[model samples]
Target: MSRTFDDTRRWVRFGTDLMLRSVGGLDDDAFAASSALPGWSRAHVAAHVAANAEALSNLVHWAATGEPTPMYASPERRAADIEQGRALPSGELTAWLRRSADALEAGMTALGEERWSARVVTAQGRTVPATEIPWLRSREVCVHAVDLATGATLADLPPDFLTALCDDAVAKRATAPGPALTLRAPTAVWELPGDGEPAVVTGELHDIAAYLTGRPAAPLTVDGAPAPALGAWL
Candidate 1:
C-alpha cells in the first residue's frame, strides 16, 4: 500500500514517540554505553537524532516563509554539533531531543498545503518538496531508536514503515554504483543496482529493510549463499 502524506505524518509521530520511550528508559550509564554503530555511544546517536530534528525544522520554516534555509550551516558544523551533543548531561540531552522534536512537529502541522509544495534542499544536497520533511524525520527516529540499543528493534516498526524504508534503500542503491542484487520480501520485490543475473536475496520484509539500512539483519541468503556485505546506507 502506498503511504499518503497523512500516513507519513502519523509515522513521524509514532516513530518519535518510540524513540523518546527508548531514550527515556536509558540510565546515565546505559546512555554512555556504545550504541549499535561502531565507535559511537548511545549519547552520540541521541544527539544526532536531536540535531537532525532541529535541522529539519529549518527546512519547514523555509518552506513556510519562503525564506532560504539550509538544513545545516555546513557539513563540518553539523558533525561538530553531534559531537558536542555527546557531552551533554543525560537529562539535558533528552530534554533537547524532546523539545526539538516537538518544535518540528508543530512547525510541520502549522504549514499550509501550499507551503508544503515549496522546494527545499536536504543536507545531502538533494532538492525536494517540503512534503518530504516528515518522511525524512520518520526514517531518522525509527532507525535511530533501534540504534540506541535500548531494546527497540525492527520488529517494533510498522510494516508500512519498513516497506517504505526498503523502498528508499533500494532506490538509493539503484542510482549509485553498487552490487547487483534482487531483494524478495514477502510482500514486495526490489531490484538493486544491477543489469542481469543479480544475486537474488530472500528474507522477511523487516530483515531485508534492516540489511539495507545497515542495521542488524536476520538470516538471509544471497543466491543460496550467505548474505552479501553492503556498503553504508549513506
Candidate 2:
C-alpha cells in the first residue's frame, strides 16, 4: 500500500519520540561513549540527526518558497557542522535535537497542499516531492535511535515502518553488484538484486531490517551456510 503524508507524519512523530527517549538519560560522558555505528560516538549520531532535521527543513522551505536552498553549502560544511555540534553538553544536544525536529515539522505543516507536490532535492541528489521529507526523517530517527546504543533495538521500531524500510533497502541495493538473495521475514519476503540463484536469508522483520541497513547481522541466518557479506549500502 502507498503511504499517505498523514501516515508518514505519524511515523515521523513516533520515530522522533523514540529517539528522544533513547538519548534522554545520557550524561556528557555517555554521549561521548562509542555508538553501535563504527567510529561514531552517541554524540556524533545525535549531532547528525539534529543537523539532518535542519537540512530537510531547508527542502521544505525550498518547496514552500520556490527558492533553490541546498541542504548544505557543501559536503565539507555538513561534516564540519556535525563535528562542531557533536561536542555540545548532553543537555544542549538534547535540546537542539528536539528543536530541530519541531522546526522541521512546523515547516512541513506550513506548506499548502499544492506545495506538498513541489519537487525538492535530497542531500543524496535525488529529486523527490516535498511529501518525501517525512519518510526521509522517519528513516533517520528510527534507525539512528538504535545506533545510539542506549537500550534501543531494531525490534523497537513499528512493524509497518520496518516493512517500509525493508522495501527501501531492497530498492537501494538493486543496482549494486551482489549475489541475488531472498530476505525472508515473518511479515514479508523481499528479493534483493533480483537475479541468479537467490541465497535465502531468514530472520524476523527487525533482524532483516538491521542486516540490510549495514547493522549487525548476528540475528539473521543464511540457508544452511554462512551469511554472505553484503557490500556497502547507504
Per-residue lDDT tens digits for candidate 2, residues 102-177, read 9998988888999999999998899999889999999999999999999989998889889988888889998888
Clashes of 2: 0
Task: Write one digit per residue (lDDT tens) for candidate 1, span 151-191.
Answer: 98888899999998988888887776667888898898888
- Give Cα-based local distance difference scores for all models: 0.89, 0.89
Question: Which pairs clash in the backbone of model 2?
Answer: none
- Each prediction's TM-score versus the true structure: 0.96, 0.96
Model 2, runs deviating above 4 Å = 194-196, 219-222
After TM-score superposition, the amount by which residue 218's alpha carbon in candidate 2 deviates from its true location, in angstroms, is 2.7
Worst 10 residues of 1 by lDDT: 218-227
The true-versus-predicted C-alpha distance at residue 45 of model 2, in Å, is 0.3
Clashing pairs in model 1? none
lDDT of candidate 1 at residue 229, scale 0 to 100 = 80
